[model samples]
Target: MKNFRMRVWWFLCVLPLLSACGGTEVTLGEDEDVAGMKGVVERIPAPYGAGCGIEIPVEASYLPDPGVCGNGICEDGEDMYSCMDCAVCGDGCCAGGERSWNCALDCGSVCGDHFCNGGETAATCRADCAPKLGSVLLQRVRSCRNRFPLPCNSTQTRSEFHWWDDFNVAQDKQKRTYLAQPFNPGRDGVRHLVFIIAGQQDGDMASGLTGQRDGFKDAFRDNDGSMWVGVDGQSLAYRLMAEVYRSPDDTFMGLAFDARFNYGFTPSNKQEIENAYYEWLKEKFYASNLRSIYLAGHSRGGCLAARLGRRFKQDFPQVPLILHIFDGVCHVNDHEFGTNGSGYLNPLMNMNGDWRAYSTNVGAQFPTTQNLAVYNMLSGDQVLGDFADYFVSVHAFSHASPSAVTPSFTEGDWYRQEWFTWTHNGMAHNTVSDALWHYQLSCNRFGC
Candidate 1:
């Protein structure tokens, strides 16, 4: 009860700052663009007709044929296929013959510089890579874990835990009860942190960072990277792991949505999830006099965070919701929303204003030819239209780092690509991770 009183007092003290404080004071003029990582106002393509939309061809070829393999052939009609024999194919069998359609025993395995193996082939291509889907996805998820840690990973101890779908405190339901065995370092206090909402990768929230979290907690005696956890908050935990950041961020937040989609946790579910999260946070820290809350997510999670921010506006509008969407954009059919997503067109004219999705991205080298529909469907989306009034598309690369492969330079910036080519290095996406955080603090530091 005493703790509850402290919380109320803390809320009163912080409420004024949140209600009156604003984000960075960068004036977003009509002609002036929102700044990019470098402080240059971002040049958001004008609305479709206004000159901001890209006229992407709506052809079937752009869609991914995951079932098909090599040079566009799927004769097996049922085999899971993969691309093989590229110079970078790590199997040391790159020069081997007739290796086409063979199982990509090491498709996404990153040994050294190149991304060897793991392409679609005629013989092994199954509809879902049956028996192997879990393995393959798990490997990818681990890769992501290996690369990004600070902004995402945690080294907390474990115990039998349960993920709360919704908080029902009345029933004595610990609401979002997840048994965190506590970190070894045994430190307690709110600290500077970031959250990476995992995408199709990183199924388990508590698995990946167990070891790392321990290290940080031992050293700093606090979860310095903030609190990295999975999205669905279910599963054995370790299955979902992918280092989407070949170009690591100073850190990351893995959401573990790899299997969540299979369930019915749609965009609408975001509000509930976020509410629970905030409630849990307040329950845990507000009384301790913690700092402000800032949230960011990529792809689907990014979309979710954006809407979550809008909802949070009613309570804490001053908090900055820094959302970074890689390839995950939400697209509602014109019939559904009564609008177009392209900036030039009134893509969102009929939109009902319910934009929410989690982070998702297509690898530069591991191009997902099957999920093109998802990207196409969401491209030029206008869901976060006004909600993202202060959004910025940070250091985007043509492809994942090291390989320096460009997906399509016909769109977006030339600087990142140019910077990569000249340096002959994989560009880091997390370079600007702190930029937004720093900017937000600066914006409010002087009472703005």
Candidate 2:
């Protein structure tokens, strides 16, 4: 009875303490008859019960929630504990490690991607590569123009021939134009005329005359005696005539038309351009008193010079006609030369005349006949390989079929070939003018 009373008292005392810590720990009977029974047991919270103030039951080894990833949405197959599991590859937006070459379908061919994929050329995407042939030609043209300005302003005598004051332009109904400039005009009837025809879309008469003036000045500087002829005390004797055509647009068609028709001679007339050249020539000089005539041209202009030279020889057989061709394009059809094996043979080369041809050996690819004296100028820069292939060809001489008749077989058979250390197209074209001036100076000094 005494022990039972003591146990009741202790149970009442412990019951209050056990009720106070209900969710934390539970105490069973001190000595229970049940198997595997303990004195005290930890109270595990219910499966969906609140433990640390939240409803979600967590294990001791549970990692913290990583939240959302990439665009803030917990995607399927993503690790609930990791945000990096949602990463995707080859996204077109260049996101998620997509590259232009590797994943071009998504990245589009953007520049600076370190890959020269798609239509990104060296000119368009220069950061990754070198310039292409087109870019090289463009740069060469710009550099040439910059190096040689329009007018020959380098010398005092050449500067006097201003475009507005000294030059006269004549335009026909077909819009074909030509310019005439008298270099040393005087009352004396004796005159030596020089006709300069520039390449397609090059420039107007001013540009041609400027090229001529610079060429003459360079020749005179080299050899003064033969170049300067005195018709009388009043005049230096040589005048310039240039056929100016329309400027080309910024498109390929414009370039083609300008090269084919604008600078080319008419198939029907053959004596002049489609429009004003013949009429303008007649109005400028009296044919009876003219001493001699020199015809010079560049590219397509060389074709025109050849055609006109043939006609001039037919018309004025007694007067001497000298032809100077500068990097002349050969085929009658401008486009056909690039396609066919016709080479650079032009009707001009076929014409029987005293000829002086100039070309840049850097780009000359065609085989030229040994009909005339050829000056092949080499360039240090070889970037214009395509240009050289298309324009400048390997010059081969053929003595079997001479284009022009010689006074003496020994003298005429001589190959007058010179190589200049120059590369630019402008420099190559301008070299003819320089040669002419030298020839004139030599003639004047030695009495030609």
Candidate 3:
């Protein structure tokens, strides 16, 4: 499919006090702007009759767009929903200034009240999503169906809930690094929590095509063709779920954690990281009124996701959960933050399974149960030849006995390993589109 992108540029608007400048001719360029915008030359009015470049806030990324759709193109539109494409809703893109908060059908769910959804009442954003209130006597009762009550299990309960956002992750980040986030928390409600973990990064390495964000938050994202890729790949899983799963009967939410939080980096740090995460995990039922969960992570995060999945599955045998390992690597970190925890990382980057069943080692130690599952996605990049010296080396899982990594459930273990051409980060940074959807379909049908 053609990767349709929307190009947004900071246009020079005529300022009120800048009438002293003359017009300057500039060339036009586009990453994915529609036709008729590629090679045009526009004259800009400058302040003081020279050249002035001052940027100002247009929209807060929330308020309604001023342009009317179906008439013409909206100014510097982001996607199909933002009313930039002028294309009507339901066409699969969120262009035309239509947002998930406004048009759930086209843009899907909004999360964290930012750009997407993650387990909150739709009515919180707009009236369309407002739960219908049925008049019962003098009071009105909200009529919502699948509100999963809390009390996750014996060890996990509602009273244990802590506002996830309040937990600052500064201890895990680099000394001066301020922009990278520790995690993005989802809302509290009866919904599915798609918890995502991002890949690893260090200062010694050069950024990839996806890691170009000012902060390391970029993820080679194919943002419904709105924002450029590598903009925010950390939250791709939840974003992809919105694109594929359109069941009005189901409500979904998501949370994304930075893999660099030193989870599983060392015995002590591993325990510390998991201690905090474990609390958050046990509180999912209380925090988001979670119904089910989908766990996905890349590189070191993948291994951690597996670890989390194992624990969650053991505790709640009746709860549904799925784990996706994107080239998982298991390593022990002993070095200081920002320095190379090189040894454990190098040997473990070759994500070989340590789990042995009858002396047969599988890809990941995680085994599937009646309700739980683990899936692995590997990059086919040759380790020594391709990414040997790259800062974030090839952490994609490769093995001689690929068939042993099957999910043992109904009808027998039928999953076969298939290698992909994406890079280590690409697995997490891609469009977060149909490929994952197809995988979910197969898993639902054939048990991971």
Candidate 4:
């Protein structure tokens, strides 16, 4: 990354007239001929038969005029000037003599447009050079993938959609800020967030929130600094229905149907989502200014957050994604919870239990892992549990009389309350926007 130093000098040619006094004609000197050269030298021709010094070769691109040189002699078809006696005129080539100059309308022959000097050649210089600008040609190439229109990489599926250029939010939105408000817009240390929505929609879900446009737009308006992406896990599964059976609505509870299908969401899908997410994430936020990312979610959403954290250090291996889980679960354990505080959630495992019972039962599967935070509020308490487990934090609150009061509610409880109660059956769970608000509040309150 060494910078080049440049200094261009223009020299005017001069010729002396010979008089009846019979003074000796002078030849050009190397010192006078070479106006702006570095690292070499030669002798010059003097009057009264003095030998002219060695001449230096100049670039032909800036050729001097042949009209009047300092040699003081008009020989052949050329005009000349005195080289030995005239100190006022530089000693360059005289008429009919060998000479050189570094001047040209096109220097492409000598050096390419963006030559070592860093300036464009005449033929390439434009009023604005932003488009032609390229990053410091990275030494290594990075891999990227896309997540939507499921059967993502299946050989059986043939998709008509073709999206290239490697999805990069940061690079594409150059100078443009995203997710602006709650988090100050244009802040360099912004983190990236990816949301993987998992659920079987028997109701009007996709219509209520256009997963791609409205969700992303609202997320951006709320906190436009971080990069955001969403993946429809159910859609992906439905697309791969040949591998698994689609559950019948009449066979299970609303939450049970989701848990039965999405709870078992495979690691393969998780890997694919993370792969595509960061491939584009890094390209967009690779600047030195980028901050660490925060992975988060709700029910199925929270599970995705955990899966990403667990394999992040393996799949993307190099990227550092901060793990944040909100009311999420991983897998079902048979450690009798009420029997020994392990599989106590077995009571609510009924396919026909209330939605709350299903949520609590699901929480058991999502125990606090070393890399993930399983945040959950106790059945009826307003205070969250051991959610502050270094990396994981949880909050519990009851919908009963006093606990439902906002004043008696904890901030974490307020989060879930506001989120689950946002729209239809908590279908409008905008983790990106929620995370942004929490991040802004946290930064403001604790200087995080």
Residue 148 CA error for candidate 4 (Å)?
A: 20
Tens-place lDDT per residue, model 3, 93-126, is: 4433344555556556654434334345443543
Model 2 per-residue lDDT tens digits across residues 88-204: 333223222233554455445667766777677555775434311110000000011112235322211222222212223211212222222323243244345555555554332
Q: What's the distance in Å from true for residue 285, model 1?
A: 2.1
Stretch of 10 with least lDDT, candidate 2 = 135-144
Indicate which candidate wins on lDDT: 3
Estimate every model's Cα lDDT from 0 to 1. 0.26, 0.33, 0.40, 0.28
Candidate 4 residue runs with Cα over 4 Å from true position: 1-204, 207-280, 310-424, 427-437, 445-448
Model 4, residue 339: what's the lDDT?
12
Quality of model 2 by C-alpha lDDT: 0.33
lDDT of 4 at 265: 36
Q: Compute the lDDT of residue 362 as modeled in candidate 2.
A: 15
Which sections of candidate 2 miss by over 4 Å? 1-190, 202-209, 212-275, 332-421, 428-434, 441-448
All candidates' TM-scores?
Answer: 0.29, 0.34, 0.44, 0.29
Predicted structure 1, TM vs. truth: 0.29
